[model samples]
Target chain A: MGQRLIARRQSLKYLGMLAGSVAGREFLAAWLPKSEKAEPIRPTESSYTPLFFEPEEFSAVEALTELIIPTDQSPGAKQAQVARYIDFLVSAASEYNPALQHEWTDGLQLLDRLSREKYQRSFHEISAREKQMLLEEMSLPEQDSGRTHPGYKFYRLLKEMTVEGFYTSQVGLIQVLEYKGLSALSEFPGCTHPEHQS
Target chain B: MGTHAAYDVIVVGSGAAGGIAAYVLTMKGLKVLCLEAGRMLDPSRDFFTHKFPYEWPYRGEGKPGQYGKLPQGMEWKIKEWTDHLYTIPAEDPYALAPGSKFTWTRLRAVGGRTNLWGRGCDRFGPLDFKPKSLQDGWGEDWPISYEDVEPYYDRVEQLIGVSGSSEEVYNTPSGKHLLPAFNPRCGEVLIRKGAVKLGIKVTPKPLAVLSRIYDNRPPCHYCGACNWGCDVGARYSSLDVLVPKLSRQKNFELRTNAPVHTILMDRSTGKARGVTYIDTRNGLEYEAYGKAVVLAASLVESIRILMNSRDREYPSGLANSSGTMGHYLMEHVAFNSIEGFFPQLAGRPTSNDDGPGESCLYIPRYNYGEKDRKYLRGWRFDFYTGCGMGPGPGARFPGFGSAYKKKIKELYPAAVQMGGYGEGLPFYWNYVEIDPGGLRDRFEIPQVRFHTTSEYDHAFAIRDEMYGQMEEILKASGAEIFPYEKESPYPLGSVTHEAGGCRMGNDSRTSVLDEWNRCHDVKNVLVVDAGCFVSHPEKQITHTIMALAYRASHHLAEEFRRGDV
Candidate 1:
């Protein structure tokens, strides 16, 4: 695929030379020299130290994100280091609004309290099955009776951030989701399905 | 204050209008100096196109609460992925009237907002030129007709390399394009058929992005990051296309980081001598002399400069003799959108759908000839698919774990959306003025306070009609549409198609600029941005802004030759 792209680019360069106006060719010479092939992205080992969450809270976050997107048929959130990304984001956000950091910290405490009440252990000490059950309960909508769970809103926020971090990561997009875009295409082959065209 | 080198013409704000004005004037052998408020950017170095989210600190999801603290002017800049293309909010600020809200999306770079534009280049038809007089009496008609600007449009379209297919729609005037149109996606093909079944005309969207290698610029590589700045110059931008060509000329000179404070006037002759500007780098003031001064500093910014140009002869403002300098503000008001999931394409594999940000299918103003509608003016519909590559509403799905991931994958390729860009009538109540309550920019110039009244009964009515049409089309396409009740029109100026602060007309009492975009009070000063728009059509205003700038500059050059100044 890389070789094909390079060949396509070279042909485009030839075509541009043939059809380009004198002024267009001049501007092209000035701007097109840096159009070299981009470097391939390699997975780097993360040396992230938790800035926002405590050590216990960071462990719970890692376990929770893994459960949310476990290593099933494809690589998941744990491989993407979603928890570390979330910590980095929240830590930087403290300068803009410290309330966000407080909310995250308090939410972690709430999860721990719920785990202690249900299974006589901290959230990080709980088993994966128990953690999944607790998360399921938290995902339940508020009933018509107006009774709400304690960690429901926090679950929603954590889930949103985890999804954002995971899907945007190289592991989730390139490996799990198989997102194939942002590359040079000679032409967009749009709408191959004939049935779609009535 | 030291005086800089003088030129025959000094064009302010090196955006679309200023760039085109400088290009046309300098091509005619007149010495020109272009003043830009922001610094220059090398797109290959500055644009974040094709960069993965992992490359960013927050993985493209900006830092939490960072957006909340940003000023209203910097809302668009809060996106960490493309923040480099925007101006710093603290350096340039504007105010809103009490109980009013407006989003003045601006870029202070050499290319202005062109660096971050959607690149949907559409032409205004004869009806759009005089919608009030021809169709309904919502506002004053443009003094110049479509025929007067048609030739200039042809020239500009060929120069910029617009890619589009001709259609039979009368409201959207056809132009000669340099390349053929982009092919429609599967979802767009479905929607086009549905639109055709409903007797709605769907034509190829005219885009400033290149289809073939027109000029020396390479064709689009389908990166889908046009808004982040086109690194390859596949899309049209003043910095890449116009400025570089003109900068090569010996007669042309460009001064970046020079924000014009006011248009300097010779009091005795009652003509614009040049301009006084601040060198933003060193905090020093300087003056550049010119025979003519063209103000293309955007709509609101240009008006702010004119309002700040207060003197003994023109106390209210430099061009405020009509007392209508900042009156009749307008923007495309109705932006109603609807999205749905198609079952047939639900599990289809994703390809290189990352073309230009613009879609292939465009539904022109269909209600132009209809007289029995609830609204006075009309709206255009743009159907698109695979335009958004990021996580969508699926990210907000209930629950988590592997089932959640499966649901997102299923819904990803099935997504399709249609949005409307409707016309807004110019109103006296929706105007901008220098804030008297003492809010100022970094340069200590008083910031503009915008006020938009709720005179949008017609706009709301058109939105309802748009929703009904969207529902019919989505239903016909065999898709499960999102609930219509949840959708609402965006606020005023949210579309960033604001116009009509310094409107052009034949009568000086009702307009700030004459028919040729020249100030009736200050003859040598011309406002060439969208500020000179008389009526805000639903179409994108950049094409008309460029065409009008070319037309006005042509006349200015002729007038100079004739010694009219």
Candidate 2:
């Protein structure tokens, strides 16, 4: 029965290959549409016109993103091209709910203003220590300060987006975590494996 | 229209539920009509070959600020571009009281939501079929037991070719599966190790996607094109397998783009005579006759269809004489869970080789058995190690130059992640009611008023516990935990495993459908979907929904032979 099944599968494969051969490249193209390709959101140039934010706002946004997902041994937020993705996402973000846009814009402006008051410097220019302190302070409850920081809302969006984008990325998912998908020779490493027990 | 095409069975909606129903009933030599609302998709052309979000006009992400096609907003958008066409818009006046948000995401296309589902298939154990007995005064027990539904589940596992291990089956029931089950990648192995150290039962998640060559379908290719649609036909979507076979049967006639208006019931006996539908193309109205009618148009749409068939017997609507047509709605309460970064698995190159099922691992419900909890029922966690590269949000990262690409390449496969996918128990107060005077959907019918779980504390508390448990497991796994900032909860109907509008029970007065999934007031009409679930299981909702469809279709076919209807 196994032999018969194998023979049947071989025949099916032969038939499939023959059909493919008969239906050449042009046939395949007409028959099957092409996949949509992922394009780089940022321009190739180092200094390009800011689409979503002014230079000042962009600098503050950069600092805020870094705080949410800091760089470690393997490049973190600064290296991921996430800022470009955000720029593209925001510039093209005319169709979103009003609450989301308001939250994001308000949050960024608030964070930058607070940074200027505390450090007498732009948010991006603040020391990493100062940045961390500011983040921690903003994360605190409003009852303690009697004023809720605008940067807190920006932090929320940055944190959520960072996790979502980072985890879904090819780099973050594969190189970092080692997720191996469908393997033809995939073996079931039973939880009871003595190695696992150890 | 012509001879009033007769059939032994008529299964509507060519989804996980309707497809299985057609395959089972037709294999028994019963003539079946499987009607779907969307176009028949050609897998080679329509599926994974080119399904990047970037491929669509919106790139799978809709316009910057536009409310998506369903009008519920873009955050809750279903995968397909056509999903925009099939789903009901939010502005259609689907009534919900203030602060009571309902996220009704239904796919009316050929394969339904199974095409873009999470591929997590689990058995709803005996505890789920009878939740009322376990807790009290919340919902009804299923007419069928876990034992009664056990054989059907086994048959389904065999037919769909599931990849799972029976040993991992704890409170989440298991069946005779195709293979032992695929294992977690190295990162998942570590997370599982940590979770187990915390006394959490982390096991291999059972997925509907093929691990090995089962039946005729190919094994998963590990392309991770599952959220869009798998063109290779490895995933468990009805279009890939069941509906295609059913279409080959001479008696089956599937009509796509046929938006069903109402189930035309006889005035004298309240029997389902036929269905009146409008062809979405020309806006022409046509009726198809069947000895029996099955409403498999999903939970939300099915409720809408029944509510539209207004008659004297069912003054509220057909099969709704009991005033329970659209009530006790339940949705799996979900959120983007606690995440953490671990440096242990860094430096590995990207491995985008696995399909949807291959990404990670599953931690079974460890809170079961003699455990005192803040909530009655329990929830499970899905763990996956992140690999591969994609752009991050600007708010989260920096750099627009080649430096960014170089960095992304370096960090592609080094992130380990886990999420808690919990089930919400049915609360009678959390239900769907129809607004007769509300503005209609695209179908021009009064929209369903959803008053389901919004302020339910038990469900919320259960979610909080899930967050705590997830953090414990991550800490055990030796990772720096990134805790959930807040309970960023999504609205009901967002999880897409939306169930429990027309719950099945022995009590005819309270429930719309009986144990066999037959409508109590209208014997000839069978309602099968997530809506028929007595209680939402700890696992995902597709397998149970498919199994219930089969059971109901089989019973309906048997009744047709017996001339019972």
TM-score of 1: 0.91
Predicted candidate 1 versus true structure: per-residue lDDT over B1-565, tens digit per residue: 4444378899998888998898888888888999999999888788888787678776554666545545332344346666666654444567878877777777888888888787888899998888778877767889999999999999889878899877667778878544888888878888888888888888888899999988899988887767678888889999889987997899999999998888888887898999989998888888999999999999888998898898888888889899888888887755535655676776666555566656777788887567677777778887666424544323434446665666566666776767777788888888888897888877776788888753478777877877888888888877665443423455566666788889999999889999899999989999999999999888888999999999999999998788786
Error of 2 at A96 (Å): 6.0
TM-score for each predicted model, relative to the true structure: 0.91, 0.77
| Best-fitting candidate, scored by TM-score | 1
Candidate 2 Cα deviation (angstroms), residue B493: 1.6
**lDDT (C-alpha) at residue B380 in model 1:** 83
Span of 10 residues, lowest total lDDT, candidate 2 chain B? B392-401
Pairs that collide, model 1: none
Among all candidates shown, the one with the greatest DockQ: 1
- Identify the runs in model 2 with alpha carbons over 4 angstroms from their true place: A1-91, A94-198, B1-5, B48-60, B68-93, B134-139, B346-360, B369-373, B388-414, B486-489
Which stretches in model 1 have alpha-carbon errors above 4 Å?
A1-49, A142-147, B1-5, B67-78, B88-91, B453-455, B484-488
lDDT of 2 by residue, A1-198 (tens): 001001111111111111122223232233222321112221123565667777766655555555554554454454554555566667667555545556667777677678899998766677766766777667433112233555554554665555444434444444433444423333433233345334
What is the lDDT for B371 in model 2?
Answer: 55
